[model samples]
Target: MSTPVIFIHGLWLHASSWQPWADLFTEHGYQTLAPGWPGDAETVEESRANPDAIAGHGIDDVVEHFARIIKGLDTKPILVGHSFGGMIAQKLLGLDLGAAAVAIDAAQIKGVLPLPLSTLRSGFPVLSNPANSSKAVSLTPQQFRYAFGNAVSEEESQELFDKWSIPAPGKPLFEAAAANFNPHSPAKVDTANESRGPLLLIAGGKDHTVPEVVVRSTLKQYRHSHAVTDIIDFPDKAHSLTIDSGWREVAETSLTWLKEQNL
Candidate 1:
């Protein structure tokens, strides 16, 4: 049977945004699927029409939802996730739930200490308001540009914003922000899993939201583990690298790494 690959999307972008990657992976003889977060609609238009449907879901909720899906699969699958999805992929992999995982510009998990100014600003739309924690928040075009499109041109940024953007539950952001303070925060990952699957963490140096420094810190959290951990840096890319015009390059890179792992 072909290897199964599951794609997980992060905040602000619909799960369908992973369709291109899924197509490419499928062509490479892999069976792939991209499932949205809990309460997500089947399409972008439907998701936008019901922001309330996307509200109040947290990091743990997302992880468990995906876990249930993984359990139904024929075998342990390869996971590729972006942004918060990346974080979720790591969490699942840490639990030995995946054959392997690729985390692209993943959000900060517990034990990640560098909170850069850009990261803060990128999350301001949700973090600025306490009440937002239980609400579904959408970013403005300008906010989207700063958080996900800064590395691309203004025109392309606007195009991306219109194409894949959606309301994201603010609860995950709040959970991540206070992760270090909470003993059992949902954002926590078992970075020290010594026998888990190999993991490749991809980071965008120019990404204002989850910068290179944060990615490096995440790498350090795996120091005690003997399991394979690798990192790739796209120095000029931003948070939008997975969805922008340069998406193929990132996808190709991930495919190459998975091939190297013989998965």
Candidate 2:
């Protein structure tokens, strides 16, 4: 039987953002599931219309939500995640949830250090306001452009923003930022878990939200683990690498890597 694949999306995007990716994987003989975070709207339009639905969710809530779904699968699936979703995939892997996993432009977890200026700037919308922690935060088109579409053209950036951007829960961002400082942080992961499946971390060179430095730091954290762990870098790509016009290339790269692992 073909291995099932679960696609986890990041902030500001619902599961619908993974539709094209789902279809692409299906065409390649993989069954796919792109489940939304708890309280996520069914569509981007709905999410935009009712931003409150996306508010107040934190890292722990999201992790448990996805963990329940994975537990119901008959077979251990191959996990694929982007941004914050990538961090979720790592948490799940530490729990021995999947057969193999791929994390793309993943957000920083507990041990990651060296926050770049661009990363801070990208998160300024939510971090700038202490009150935002309990609220949902929406990004302006310019913020989206800087954080997610810097590698693409202005027209393309606007198109992506209009089609996929939505409000995201601010609590998660705040939680992730304070992870290292909080001993009981929900963003903590067991990077040394020997049972964790083979993992691959993909980095986007131009990604402002989760820069290469952050990705490298995450990889460094897992260096002590016995589980197979590797990284691939796309020097010209940005945070939107998984959803941009060239997303197919990134998907194909992941598929090839999975095949090489005999997944």
Candidate 3:
């Protein structure tokens, strides 16, 4: 049987947004699944209509949710995740649950110390108000433009927002922001595990939400491990690299990397 590939989405985007990537991977002869967070609805409209269902879910909750899905698989699968999904992928891989993982513009994990101003600004909609920590927060088109589409045209940014944006739980952001200070943070990843499978981290230089520096910092966290860990930088792309018009480029790159790893 072909190896299974699980796609995990991050904040503000519905799980179905990965359909294009999933279709492409399927065409390449891999079985793929893109599951949402613990409380995500089946559709974008439904998720927006009932934000409370998605609110208050933290990092550990998301990791465990995906872990359960992995538990049902017949064989170890490759994990390809974006943003917070990227962080989740790493955590699972560290636990020796995946055959490989590709993290795109992954959210900052524990031990990454640089918190850029742009990162703060991008997360301000939820982090600005402590009350939002327990709520599901939606981003305005303008905010999405800054956080995820700054590298694309304004029109394209707005279009992307209308098509895929959804309310995101604020708890993950709160947990990540405080990850450095908390020893037992859910944002923590067992990067020191040398027995795990290979990991590829892709960064977007123009991404305001997760800048190149942050991705680099995340890479450093894996320095102690002997397992294969690599990073790629798309200097012209932003956080929306996974869902934008140029998404195929990123997807193709990931597929190529997976093939090279003989996965």
Q: Which digits, one per residue and each the tens of the lDDT, describe model 2 over residues 37-108? A: 888888888888988878999989998998899889999989999999999999988889889889999999
Q: Residue 23: error of model 2 in Å?
A: 1.2
lDDT of 1 by residue, 75-97 (tens): 99999999999999999999999
TM-score of every model versus the real structure: 0.99, 0.98, 0.99
RMSD of each: 0.5, 0.8, 0.6
The worst-scoring run of ten residues by lDDT in candidate 3 lies at: 58-67
Candidate 2: residue 82 Cα off by (Å): 0.6
Error of 1 at 159 (Å): 0.7
The TM-score between candidate 1 and the true structure equals: 0.99
Over 4 Å off, model 2: none
Give the range of the ten consecutive residues with the poorest summed lDDT in model 2: 12-21
Clash totals for all candidate models: 0, 0, 0
- In model 1, which runs have C-alpha deviations exceeding 4 angstroms? none
